[model samples]
Target: MSDHLTVVDHPLVQHKLTLMRRCETSTSEFRQLLREISLLLAYEVTRDLPLTSRQIETPMCAMDAPVLEGKKLALVSILRAGNGLLDGILELIPSARVGFVGLYRDEETLEPVQYYNKLPSQIGDRACIVVDPMLATGNSSAAAIDLVKQAGGRDIRFLCLLAAPEGVARMREAHPDVPIVTASLDDRLNEKGYIVPGLGDAGDRMFGTK
Candidate 1:
């Protein structure tokens, strides 16, 4: 898609996201809402997956049926909070290959620090969708995408629960080829580089960690 950013404004997604934004949402509630919303976002992200027909026979009928054309798409989670989004998307595309890129933002610099990386063997052969719950500074996301490319991943797309305009701009400048999909693009990043009016630190909210 030519659009660099896609905001999944579907009613279901928006409603669930609103629930997630509430400060009092319990850990269980936040997790459940994220799972539900990720499925909807996944549906949008995978909408154009190439299709081909496979022959199938029924008791009284035989015909070609549409099936995904190639290797199942790759779903790469950008660590920690990304796992929250990953779990739900996997429920929707059960056959997808999974990968992970672990990164932590350096508190002082607000830049990404890589801690771990693993990917499917045939990353290049499958469409890749990278998942993260927040796109704040975009440093980590861009760095994660760099690792994906280094591992031979192409046709990559980014999916996030929330994004800031600064983060979107950062991605556009760093990896214009990769399009981003998010539930909402908030106003701007605060001085600390967090998305203003974001649902707080996604990892903390998702896992009930400090």
Candidate 2:
């Protein structure tokens, strides 16, 4: 894929995303909606995955069938919030390898500090999708990607439910080679570094936390 952003505008994805954005949506419903939407987003992210033909036996005869080429794709969740998206994508790409990069923002500096990281052995040879629900400031996301690269991830794409203009710009500058895919690109980040008009604290909303 080109080095650009892809906003998934499918009707179902938009409708489900709307539900997720509502303040009154319950944790159970919000989680369900995120799962539903992530499936559609996965479809778009993997749209151009390379395919190879293999001989298969049909009921009537043997024929060549298309199958995914190379090693199974890798799914790396960017901790807490990313787990929501990860669960859904796993349902669709069940055979994919899994990894996690945990980061928490330092309140004083508003910068990301890595606390945990575990990646697949063959990450460099496989396509890796890093998932997070919100791309608010992009610091943590970029840091997570850097960790993935350090662990040998080369072909990487970022997936998020919502993104702010500031966050998109940050990603563009820091990692232009990594394509970004999201459901919506909101206006901008607020004073506290949250996405404006965004669903409040995706991790808190999805997990019923304060």
Kindly give the stretch of ten consecutive residues in candidate 1 with the minimal lDDT sum: 1-10
lDDT of 1 by residue, 1-210 (tens): 248999988999999999999989999999999999999999988887899999999898999999999888899999899999999999998989999999999989999999899999889999999999999999999999999999999899999999999999999999999999999989999999888898899999998997
Q: After superposition, how far is residue 128 of candidate 1 from its true place, in Å?
A: 0.6
> How much lDDT does each candidate structure score?
0.93, 0.92
TM-scores, all candidates, are: 0.97, 0.97
Q: Indicate the residue-level lDDT of 110 in model 2.
A: 75
Q: Residues 83-108, candidate 2, lDDT per residue (tens digit)?
A: 99999999999999999999988877
Clashes of 1: 0
